[model samples]
Target: MPSSNKNLSVSVIIPVHNGGESFRRCLSSIAAAVPPPHEVIVVADGDTDGSWCVAQEYYTTVLRIPVCSGPAQARNLGARTATGDILFFVDADVTIYPDTIRQVAIAFSCEPEVAAMIGSYDDAPGAKNFLSQYKNLLHHYVHQTACEEASTFWGACGAIRREVFFAVGGFDNRYRRPTIEDIELGYRLKQAGYTIKLCKSLQVKHLKHWGVISLLRADFFYRALPWTELILRDRQPLNDLNLQLLSRLSVISIFALLGAAIASLWWTALLGGVVVFSGVLLVLNAPVYSFFVRQRGWWFALRVIPWHWLYYFYCGLAYAIGTSRHYWRQKKQLAFGN
Candidate 1:
């Protein structure tokens, strides 16, 4: 339980823009949660969707950024205006569960060395579709387990001491694009020798609205751009198993196309190989899919599988393109002054 003292306060910063039903749900959940924030700061970024008015109904501390400054900027602005010792930055679409704030407070109290703590999101229960399942699996692989050498924390439901946040100069506004701001900020914090802990008790319910086209666009912007940035900064070759799969896929695709133009027998052999490779990818992802199906049932799984494969293909392609572009741009910039 949080102490009744007003001095030990927490400010929840929610950045919003055109968030429809999700925004309302997000706010309600926060309000419902135990140990409510001392103040809920909602940064409305040029929202023409009446999201600001909706927020006004619930929160008194609202800042409307004149233009659409993106989430990182909005979050920074909120942080600057927050009066709390701890800043809880959450997305407008997430619905945090009860006891989340209490858990975060307890974690910090227990571990004085921990600079920050991140919570888990409730992956949609009936989200059996391929893309949804893959996304959930990917998230689980990266975060569900604790890290002894903790580096990055998810931005969705993360808390940081005001002093630590200022020390790192907040998030880099240069990453104004869709989804990498969190990862980039986390990277910077790690570089500055701050410990980020993943707390299982602090949970948020994430409502993913993923379709085929949405998944593709997400791959291009979210997954691809950040990955490319990481590769550029780290200067490490893509040695992950996912990258290896993409390489194998690309090779098979090349041979299959070449054989089609040359001989019928070779074409048949290449086609068979491609089918086998596709089957292997599906099989590799089956355990995760099965888990989703068991949780959500078969109907959701059928819809999610194809979407997942499409996401995988596009994500791989986007990463390849983004990384190439980053390298080319860097080389060009170095060669030319402007």
Candidate 2:
């Protein structure tokens, strides 16, 4: 139970780049929260789109970085200036629910052991495109169903105890982009024996639109590669969060089936392999497809299935390249040292 005398205050930190209307909407949502945060810090990381001006429109403290520093650095700067006991990190493209801050405070109050916690995007994404829906909804489903004792943290709507965050050195500035910074911080917290929880009940609406190519590129380069590097350096088990045993096995099966399909000389065998891979992919992602069907209609789910399969294929390839590169770099460095 929370101590009667200690009131935990929250400081909401938002990192902005070039977002325009989305940034405005995000600030509006934060302002409208029932119990507003103790402070709202908007760190402008070289915004040429006049987003900093929009920040000035709200009752927010704006930190202007003339150079285009990434979200990681921007967030760290915000954390440094935050006066609250809890630091809430919200992205510039997400709209929070009115109860988000209250729920976060309650979470910290109720569970003194939890060092950090993350929430997911709601099913109703603000983007109307099909690719946007597929990407955003898939994220929502995974985060909602993930283990409560999560292995990683998300920057979309994650909060950390202010002191604990500083103790773990906050977000690693090496991640100049939005990729894997929060997860890296989570790994450090776990290494220091702190618990991070996934609160699915607290949700935000994502405003960013994702194209198919951009999504694939982000999956491969930004996420898979960086995440693989982090795991390699930390030497952590891959059985946590999204990389559970069943999910790995599914990725393996899909890869093997696809490889066979590509290498087969006979057209009939190639066709058979494609059929087998499709079956396995469908089986592995049945629950995800069902979730989509419920959120949208069956027709939307059917339309998205092919692209999802392609997504898995590319992600598997990315994992392969990332792991191989990690090992090769380690070997090269060791050889040079010797």
TM-scores, one per candidate: 0.81, 0.96
Q: What is the lDDT of candidate 1?
A: 0.71
Tens-place lDDT digits, model 1, residues 1-338: 22333345678999998889889988988888688887899999878898999998886588998778788899999999998878999988778878877776666666778888787666552255566555655555335544533566567888998889999999777756557787777777877889887775567766566566776676677766676667578664443333444444644444444445356465555566556555665676676567657766888777666655655656656666777888898899989965
lDDT of each: 0.71, 0.88
Top TM-score prediction, candidate number: 2
* Poorly placed runs, candidate 2 (over 4 Å): 1-5, 267-270
Write down the RMSD of candidate 2 (Cα, Å): 1.7
Quote the positional error of residue 185 for candidate 1 in Å.
0.4
Root-mean-square deviation of every model: 4.6, 1.7
lDDT of 2 by residue, 1-338 (tens): 23634779999999999988999999999999989999999999998999999999997999999989789999999999999989999999999989999999988988888889999999999999999998899888888888889888788899999999898899988888878898888888888998999998989999998987788778888998888788778888557666877567678877877777877855556777777877887888788889888999999999988787676677678777888999999899999999
Candidate 2, lDDT over the whole model = 0.88
Clashing pairs in 1: 128-300, 128-301, 129-304, 129-305, 130-304, 130-305, 130-308, 131-308
Poorly placed runs, candidate 1 (over 4 Å): 1-8, 125-142, 145-150, 236-266
